[model samples]
Target: MTDSDVTISMFERIGGSATIDRLVDRFYDRMDTLPEAKMIRAMHADDLGLIRDVLKRYLTEWTGGPRLYTPEKGHPRLRQRHFGFAIGDAERDAWLLCMRGAMEETVTDGAARQDLNKAISGLADWMRNRT
Candidate 1:
């Protein structure tokens, strides 16, 4: 089957907003504490609350639940937003490491986990702003 055919909406696979919140929380938690995440973690503000909310809303719309982020923030423009940061291979890998841990803790379905991992990996790679 094609990837789209096998793909489930991130909302359904992740159990909606509550689960997304948990996932984001766990992701930030790891970023805050993990030694490997130090470089990427330093890029974020001391207060992660707003960032968490933004991510939660963005993921909600991305997964087909609601368009909350777009309505408030306009287009995602993910790459553009990340351009101000010095995202290289190390930073990208650190972000992915945190996200992978979060996904492992939040998603139980093997297929869903793989799908999310693939998408996240691609996004992380795309976020790399430096050579």
Candidate 2:
């Protein structure tokens, strides 16, 4: 199959919200535990429940599922939202490391994992507020 055929919506490819839930859950769990992710994890609050929901909703809309984020949070001005944080190369790389580990633990399909990684890389790069 061509790339287009292989390119399923992040929702369908990930088995819907259930899979997303698992992915996000495992992601936070890893972030909470991994040494390499310590810096990024420190940025977040002690409570990860709300953040997890936000991520799920945001990803839901982002992956061509539903427009939950836009409706609830308005436009996703990700860079603006992240501007308060010091997102230098180190921070960005750390975030990517955490996300990559999460993806590996959660995603099973090769194409879907690659697509999510590419999109995440772009988003992480965009979230950079510093060098």
- What are the TM-scores, per candidate, against the unseen true structure? 0.92, 0.90
Give the distance in Å from residue 38's predicted Cα in candidate 2 to where it truly belongs: 1.2
Find the number of clashing residue pairs for candidate 2: 0
Identify the runs in model 1 with alpha carbons over 4 angstroms from their true place.
Answer: 1-8
For residues 42-87, what per-residue lDDT tens digits would candidate 2 score against the true structure? 9999999999999989988888787878988998888888777899
Residue 47 C-alpha lDDT in model 2: 100
How far off is residue 119 in model 2, in Å?
Answer: 1.1
C-alpha lDDT score of every prediction, in listed order: 0.90, 0.86
The TM-score between candidate 2 and the true structure equals 0.90
TM-score of 1: 0.92
> Which residue segments of model 2 deviate by more than 4 Å?
1-7
Instruction: Choose the strongest candidate by TM-score.
Output: 1
Per-residue lDDT of 1-131 in model 1, one digit per residue for the tens? Answer: 77878866778887888888888999999999999999989999999999999999998888777788999999999999989999999999999999999999998878878988998899889988899
